[model samples]
Target: MADAVTEFVLTPEQQDLRRAVRRFCAERLGEDTVRRLAESGTGHDPALWARLGGELGVLGLAVPEELGGAGGGLVDQAVVAEEFGAALVPGPVLGTVGLAVPALVALAGAGLDEDLLASLVEGARTAAFAVPDRGGRFDPALVTVTETGGALTGEVRHVVDGTADVLLVAARTGEEIGLFLTDGGERIPLSTLDRTRRQATVRFSATPARALAVGAGAEQAITAALRVGGALLAAEQVGGAQRMLDRTVAYAGTRLQFGRPIGSFQAVKHRCADMLVLVEHARSTAFHAAWALQDGTDDPDLAVAVAQATCSQAYQQVAQESVQLHGGIGFTWEHAAHLYLKRAVTDAALLGSAAEHRERIAQLVLDGASASGGVRVATG
Candidate 1:
């Protein structure tokens, strides 16, 4: 039985949207389409992205309605992200929706850059969020870029949405950090584990940039945006893991050995069952985190962290098991199982590893206790 509370999370309209996206991905974003796009060296089809943005209204899902967005909010993003993950839909959707939109939304709250935000909302433009990669984490300390005489000079690694029309840079200015909207630079694409998504290094060589926001306001907005990004990523991971589990289980029920389906064996049955548990756990955590973040619940950060840590491991485990349970054929290049595994591992390390998130979770709990005076010590 489904939980009553969870059932209402998606209104009738949202449910319809999910069904529509699932159908589109099934009909258009097929395995062949994804493979062809990957091999074409572009790794993304502008036509497909345009359809999604112009027709489905995904590009502007997070933006405010006054600025031309659907104003669907974070939960809506999570729902769409899950479908994207399930189909392994390849493109800059993750970067455009997850990172850049949040930055704009945050900036919008502070009443800055309405024109830029409007352009993005109309799908006429796109932006990639660039943050210095610090050992698999987006640590503020990694930002060492400086601005002088209106020219920005710094480098940020592992920027998502390689096809973005612009860059939303998180840069450091002396002791204060700020964000800048740049006209993009040379994008050095890196060979990443997942070919479905694109990433690159953007080097600013005295690049002329326009500042979006500065000081405390910029910091708060960016932080909130990144947190939403991390939570939505967990939703993606959960969706991918679910797809892998479904594929593995279906294969198990059909593949025969010694005149019997392999699924009949005790060992194989256990593996499939375990995979189900992982997928379910991942789904629950991802949805809860999305809800908390969307509703602005108390301690949203803690909820997001818990979801990131729990869902990361769940997705990785199911993806890894999927390959092994599929036997010899799963090891071949023709098999899609390996691709899911690669994506799983890559997404696990995107914001931070499960282990790293666990560390943060512990710190958050302790810090919260101390802040609220929840801790007590008695000594003679």
Candidate 2:
């Protein structure tokens, strides 16, 4: 009962939006649709993408209304993300809400580029961060950049939605880090294991670029944007994990062994129970991060790290365990369990890994303690 009624102090509007989005995903993008989308090599449904961007208005959930967005906050978008996760709906919800929108907003805050932000918010355009390289460690300082006339040149890899119309690229220009908006840069193809998200190795060979922001301020803006995106991705992972758990439980109940429900057995029951607990915990952590992000709390960054670390593991664990509990059929092409597993693994490493985020949290805590007047001498 508590599981069904677990409350997170959401506004009535947020609750209604959640219900609506959930119903929408269940009706339109159900198990069959999700399976089809995941199996596609492109890792997305372009038709569904158009609907999400143009009709459902999910693309603009985090965008401001004045800029043609729905004027919703991070919490509001988290509700939709939760539904997206639960349905295993494939596309770029995290790409748009988490990365693109936040990048624009952060840049706008710095008064960098209003036109880019407007295009992003209106859903007429999209952008992906070209931060991570082949090793997947995205340090702004390590990024190499060159400028020739009005063009910028460099090689950046693992860019999400790299095929988008616009790209917000972070490049190192001497001692200054720069954010560039490039509409037409050379995109090199890269092999991807996950079929639900597209990635590319970009080669900007003196491509025409507009400077969105620069200097240490660019690094700060990009980092803040990534944090926002990472927190939202956790919510998406929670949704996906919940859906996997539901599907696995339903399968366990129906798949017979020894002339009885497999779910009736202790082993299967334990696995299902563990999945449930992890999903619930992931939900709590994701909501906490979303709340902090929406409220603009001082500890939102730490909350984001915690949520990403916990939710990433929870998603992967639930997905893999769900597939295992389904038996041999789960390994086949007909079943959707493996698809969820792929999405889980891909998303887990997207923003950062569990280990990476945990390390970041430790560092943040240490920094906080150091900033607090060299620690307090507590009384016994």
- For 1-380, candidate 2 gives per-residue lDDT tens digits of 11223336787888888888887787889778776776576556666666666777777687777666788887788888888777776665556567867877776666456676665554566677776522123475567766556688888777776777777777766667788777778876566666666777788887998777778677766777777787778898998898888889898899999999999999889889999999999988888777666665437667787888899999999989988898898898788787778878888778778898888777667655764456322110
Give the top-scoring candidate (lDDT).
1
Question: What TM-scores do the predictions have?
Answer: 0.92, 0.88
lDDT of 1 by residue, 1-380 (tens): 23435533688877898899899999999988888877667678877877888888876776678766887777787888899999888877667778777877888756467877766665667678886543234567778667776678877778877557888787777678888888856788988888888888888888887788888876776777677788888989988999999999999999999999999999999999999998888877777777766665435666677778988899889988998989999898999998888889888888777888788777767654675577422110
Least accurate 10 contiguous residues by lDDT in model 1: 371-380
- Name the lDDT of candidate 1: 0.78
Which residue runs of candidate 1 sit more than 4 Å off their true CA positions?
Answer: 1-9, 109-111, 133-138, 370-380
Q: Among all windows of ten consecutive residues in candidate 2, which has the lowest summed lDDT?
A: 371-380
Instruction: Tell me the whole-model lDDT of each prediction, alpha carbons only.
Output: 0.78, 0.75
Deviation in angstroms for 244 in model 2? 0.7
Residue pairs with backbone atoms closer than 3 Å in model 1 (clashes): none
